[model samples]
Every structure is written in C-alpha cells, then in structure tokens.
Target: MPLLEAHGLIKSFGGLRATDTVDLAVEPGTVHALIGPNGAGKSTLVNLLSGRILPDAGRIVLQGQDISKAPAYRRVQMGIAYTFQITSVFPNMTIEANVELAAMARHKARDAMAQAVDHALETVGLSDRRQQLAGDLAYGHQRLLEIALGIVQKPSLLILDEPTQGLGDAEVQWFVDLLKSLRSETTLLLIEHNMDVVMAVADTITVLQFGRVLASGDPESIQSNAAVQSAYLGG
Candidate 1:
C-alpha cells in the first residue's frame, strides 16, 4: 500500500469547489511534487491533508488506516507533519528554545529532548545561532527553522509548502539540496513553484489546475507533458 493516499477528495466553499475529486498517492522514500498556477488550490489541498481543513468528501489513508476525520494534533501524532509556506516560530524565543519545545512535544522528555533540539538545529545548519531569537534570524534561516520544526518529530511523511518561496538563487539551491538529502529518511510531499527545483529533485510530479489534477507522472514525463506546459509551464 502507498504510504499516503487521498481518494476522491473534495472541498467546497459555498458554491465553489476548491478541490474537485482529487486522488493522489505517495509512496515511501520518494519526493512527490505538487505544482500548479496561482489559485490552483495547492495550499488548500495541503491544508486538507494536514487536517487544518476537513475535506467535504474523501478518504485519507495513511499507512493503511483512515485518517479523514483526524484532528491536526492527532494527524501529527500519526506521523503527518506539515510546514507552512509562511514561517512559523516563536518570535520572542531563541531558536534553540523553539526547537527544544518541538522536541519536548514529540518525546515528552527533557534532557534527551534538548539533545534532539541540538540535533535538529545542527541538521538545519542553525546551531550557530541557537541563542539568537527566532525573529532575529535571516529570512532564509527562519524558513529553515520551519522545516526543522516539522522534522523534529521524526514523522514518516513531511509536507512542505513553498519552502523556498522568497529566497534568492543561492539560498534556493541550498534548500533544494537540503530537501534532496531528506529522501532517504522520510517521504516528502512538496508544493512548490520553481520548475528547476522540481525538475531536479521530484521523483513524481502532479500538476493541479483549477483545483483538479491535470497531469501526473515521473519527472521527465511531466517536464515534457504538453498539457502541463500549457497550463503551468506557459510555453
């Protein structure tokens, strides 16, 4: 069975449907990229999967168990961790403190959790600024902190939404490399706009247009898909 599966997912706001009968499957140890134009409901779908928004109709199965009605915290406990497009950290607390809190939440221990925090900071290359307040870090570092929090719990599936949104070229490349290195440890569901990054790292690409899946295939096939080119690649 797939590590994660979404079957006939639907979400509607009054009369308009944001997600229209979307079906997706993600296997373990692969990076699955969800790409689309603006207003294509990529974020909405992410929200639904993460339990931030319940779908109107669908079956969300994780590790062969139905999680369609699970709450956000419950989903996290079940190994579904989602990092938002916007950075989310404790502005008043140091990076170490923020990460330590996440680690504590995961393990319910103190000293060992502190060590886990250190490990996560080091993994994200934020150990040097461990004492710096989260808000004082550079934007790229803040983005890294968001990812660090997501993985601090060591979830089976990690979902990232536009993790490189505002970074410059070098920073974006760094983030891409960071993501590439994670495939061995966890399955990643990424929603991103940069075609270059997607082409470089995504094992499978699923295109969303107007809240519906337009095309899905391996990276090379998606790159050469005429429909994907017109809908999102823009010639």
Candidate 2:
C-alpha cells in the first residue's frame, strides 16, 4: 500500500468548497509534487492532512491506519511531519535549541533530543551554525532550520509547502538538491509554485484546479498534458 492515501477528501468553509473530493496516493521514499494556481486548495489540503483542520468528509489513511479523526499531535506521533510555507522557528532561541525542542517533543528522552539536534544540523549542513540565533540567520537558513525541526525525528512522511518561496536562484537550487537527497530516505509531499524545481524532482505530479484534481501522472505525462499546460503552465 502507498504510505499515505487521501480518499474522497472534502473540506468546505460555509458555502465555499476549498477541497472537493480529492483523492491522492503517495508512495514511500518518493517525491510527489502537488501543483496548481494561487487559489487551488494546495494549502487547504495540506492543512487537512496535518490535522490543522478536519475534513468535512472522507478518510485519510497512513500505513493502513485511519487518521481522518486524529489530532495534530497524534498525527505527528504517527510519523507525519509538516512544514509551513512561512518560516516557523523560535526567533529568540538558538538554532540548536529550536531543533532540541522539536526533538524533545518527538522523543521525550534527553539523549534522543541531543542526537536529534545533532542529526538535524548535520542533515542540512548547518552544524557549524547551530549556536546562532534562529532570527539572526539568513532567510534560507531560517527555512532550513524550520525543516530541521520538522524532520529531527525522522518522520516517515514529510510535507513541505512552498519551501522555496522567496529564495533566489542559487538558494532555490540548493533546496531542490536538498529535497532530492531527502527522497531517498523519506516520502515527500511537496506543494510548490516553482514548476521547474517540481519537474526536476518529482517522480509523480498531481495538478489541481478549483479545488479538484485536474490530472495526475508521472512527470513526463504531466509536462505534456494539454489541460495542465493551459491551467497552470500558461503558454
């Protein structure tokens, strides 16, 4: 079975349906990209998956278990990690401290927290800057720190929302490489506006339009899909 599955997911806000019966499957150790226009319900779907918001209907199953009614912390304990589009680090804390907090939350043991912090810094090649204050780092570093916190426990599934949003060309490339490396170890569900990066990294691509699935296929097919081109990759 796929590591993550969303079947007939539906979420509505009063009269507006942000997510309308969306179904998706993500395999283990693969890069899956979800792409669409500005109001295409990407973030809304992610919120539903991470338990920030409950779906109005449908089931989300992770590893043969139903997580549709699970709380956010319970979802985390079930090995789902989510990072927001905006950077979310403890501004006043050191980068190491920020990671330590996440480690503690995930692991409970002091030794595990230290190991998690060390591994997190090492994974992002930020070991040298662990002592720096989170707010003092550059925007890219701040974003990396946020990722570190989310993955310190090595969750089976990682969800990243627009991870390269405000980055420059070089930083964008760095994130692409970082994500590529991560795919070998953990399943990644990426919501990104950067089509180039998405095409380069994703094994499968799913397109959304008006909160519904427009198309889903391997990277090659998605690139050639006429409807997808017209809806998202404007000619």
Candidate 3:
C-alpha cells in the first residue's frame, strides 16, 4: 500500500483556488518531490498535507488512516514530521539539546531519547558539534540541524518545504547525498525549486501548474515531459 494518499484535495484562498482537485500518492521508502513554478500552489498543497491548513474538500490518507481532519499534533503522533523552508532550531540550545527536545516528544524514556538524539546527530554529521549552540552554526549547518530535528521524530512520512532554498553549491550537493542515504529509512515528500537536487535524489517527481497536476513520473520522464518542460523547465 502507498504510505500516503491525497484524493481530490482542494483548498482556496479568498477567490483563488490554491489547490484544485489534486491527487497524489507516495509509496513507502521513496523520495517523492513536488516541483513547480511560483504561485503554482506547491506550498498550499504542502500545507494541506501537513495539517497547517485544512482542505476545503477531499481526504488525506496516511498509512490507510484518514487524516484530513486530524490536527497537526495528531498527525505527528501518527508519524508525520514536517520541516519548514525556514530554519526552526532553537538558537540558544546546544545541537544535542535541540534534537533532544524532538526526541523527548517521541521517546518518553531517558535511554531511548539518548539513543535517538545520538543517532540523529550522527546521521546528520553533527555528533562532533553536539555542544555547539544552534545560533553559532553557519546557515548550511543550521539547515542540517532542522533535518536532524525531523529524523529524530522517526516519522513514517517526512514533509520538507524547500529544504535547500539557500545554500552554496557544495552544500546542496551534500544535502543530495544525505537524502539518498535516508531513502531506506523513511519516505520523503519535499517541495524543491532546485532542478539539480530534484533530479539527483527524487525517485518520483510530480509537477504542478496553476494548482493542478501537470505531470508525475520518474526523473527522466518528468525532465522530458513536454508540458513540464514548457511550464516549469523553460524548454
């Protein structure tokens, strides 16, 4: 079964329909990317999935359970972790403490929290900087911390909004490798503007145009799709 499914999701802002009759399916343990031009409703669709905003109509199913009306916290409990486009780390907190907070939420026991925090930091290559304050880290490292916060939740589906928005070329490449490494552990649903990152890591790519699905398929097909090329890829 697919890990998550959105059936005819519809959301509107004032007179503008941000998402219109959208349907999406994400299989387990794959990197699924949502790509589109600005004002294409990618963020709006993500908000609907993350429960930040409720859909005007339609249903969101996660792991065979309907989560369309479920509150954000309830979705978290059901194993959905969301990372924002902007960094959300606690500035004053140590790197370990930052991730520990997320771990504590999911893991009530002391030992489990320890293991989770340790593993998360290790996975993100922040084990060596566990004592550093979050605010002191560079922008790229801060982005990595945000991802650590997500993985610490041990979510079944992780929704990342523009996870690589502001970073240098080297950092973007590194993030790509990290996503590839993470593919086996959890399903990733991300909104990405960078075509290189999308092509590098995405197992499946969905293109949206004017609040509707234009094309969805593997990377090669999406890259070659005539509609996608004209609408977003500027072919």
Candidate 4:
C-alpha cells in the first residue's frame, strides 16, 4: 500500500469547490511532487492532507489508518510533518533550542531528544550554528532551520509547501541538494512551483487542475504530457 492516500476528497466554499473529489497516493521512499497553476487548490489539498482543514467528504489514509478527521497535532503525532511556505521558527530561540524542542515533543528521554536534535541540525547543515539565535541566521539558513525543526521529529511523511519560494538561484540549488540527501530517510510530498527542481528531484509527479488530478507519471512523462503543458507549464 502507498504510505499516504487521499480518496475522493472534496471541499467547497459556498458556491466554489476548492477540492473536487481529489484522489492522491504517495508511496514510501519517493519524492512525490504536486504541481499546478496558482489557485489550482494545491494549498487546499495540502491543508486537507495535513489536517489543518477537515475535508467535507472523503477519507485520508496514512499507513492504512484513516486520518481524515484527525486534528493537525494528531496528524503530526501520527508521523506526518509539514513545513509551511513561510518560514516558521522561534526567532528568539537558539537554533539548537528550537530543534531540541521539536525533538522533545516526540521523544521522552532527554538523551534521545538531544541526539535527535543534533542529527537534525547536522542533516540540514546547521550544526555549526546551533548556538546562534534563529533571527540572526541568514535567510537561507532560516529556511533550513524550519526544515530542521520538522525533521527533528523523524516523521515518516514530510510535506513541504513551496520550500524554495523566496530563495535565489544558488540558495535554491543548495536547498535542492539538501532535499536530495533526504530521499532515503522519509517519503516527501512536495508542493513546489520551481519546475527545474521538480524535474530534477521528483520521483513521480502529479498534476492538479481545477482541484482535480490531471495526470500523474514520472518526470519524463509529465514533461511530455501535452495537456499538462497547456494547463500549467504554458506550452
């Protein structure tokens, strides 16, 4: 079974439908990219999957358990972690402290939390800045720290929303490298606009349009899909 599945998800706002019976599956140990034009309901789907917004209809299955009605925190506890498009970190806290707190929430023992924190910091290349206040870090480092905080909990599924939104070319490349290094550790559900990064790193791609799946395939197939190109890629 896939690691995550959304079956017939539907959500509407008054006369408009934000998610129109969307069905998606994310396999374990693969980087799955969800891409579409703006207002295609990508964010709505992410919110539904992350449990920030309860679905009006349909079920969400994570590792065989239904989590459609679960709260956001419960979803996290169930091994789903999300990083928003905007940076989210305790700016006043030290980098290590921020990571340590995330670890503590998931781990009981102090030693275990410390180990997880160190591992996360090192994984995101923030070990050297562990003692620096988060607000003091550069913009790229702040983004990395947000990711570090999410991974410190060792979630089975990590959902990243526009992770490279504001990054420059070099920083985006660095972030892509960082994501590549994480492929083996967990399954990723990425909502990204950068086609270069998506084509480079995605194991599989699913295109959404009008809040529904337009197509799904490997990078090559997605790139060649004439409908997809016309809808979102501006063919």
RMSD of each: 1.1, 0.9, 1.0, 1.0
Q: Write the per-residue lDDT of candidate 3 for residues 164-193, one digit (tens) a residue.
A: 888999999889999998898899998999
Number of clashing residue pairs, candidate 2: 0
State candidate 1's TM-score: 0.97
- What is each predicted model's overall lDDT from 0 to 1? 0.90, 0.90, 0.91, 0.91
**Residue-pair clash count for candidate 1:** 0
> Which stretches of candidate 4 lie above 4 Å from their native place?
none
Residues 1-235 of candidate 1 have per-residue lDDT tens digits of 7999999999998887889999999999999999999989899999999999999999899999999999988888788889988777989999988887776556666776776677778778998999999989889899999988987878799999999999899999989899998887789999999989998889999999988999999998988999988888988
Candidate 4 lDDT, 27-125, residue by residue in tens: 999999999999899999999999989999999999999999999988888899888887778899999988887776577788878888988999999
Q: Please identify which of the two predictions, 2 or 3, would achieve the higher lDDT against the true structure.
A: 3
Q: Write the per-residue lDDT of candidate 2 for residues 1-235, one digit (tens) a residue.
A: 9999999999998898999999999988889999999989999999999999999999999999999999988988889999988777889999888888777657877887788789889888799998989889999888888789888967899999999999899999988889988887689999989989998899999999999999999999998999999988996
Model 1: residue 60 alpha-carbon error in angstroms: 0.3
lDDT of 3: 0.91
For model 3, how big is the CA root-mean-square deviation?
1.0
Output candidate 4 Cα RMSD: 1.0
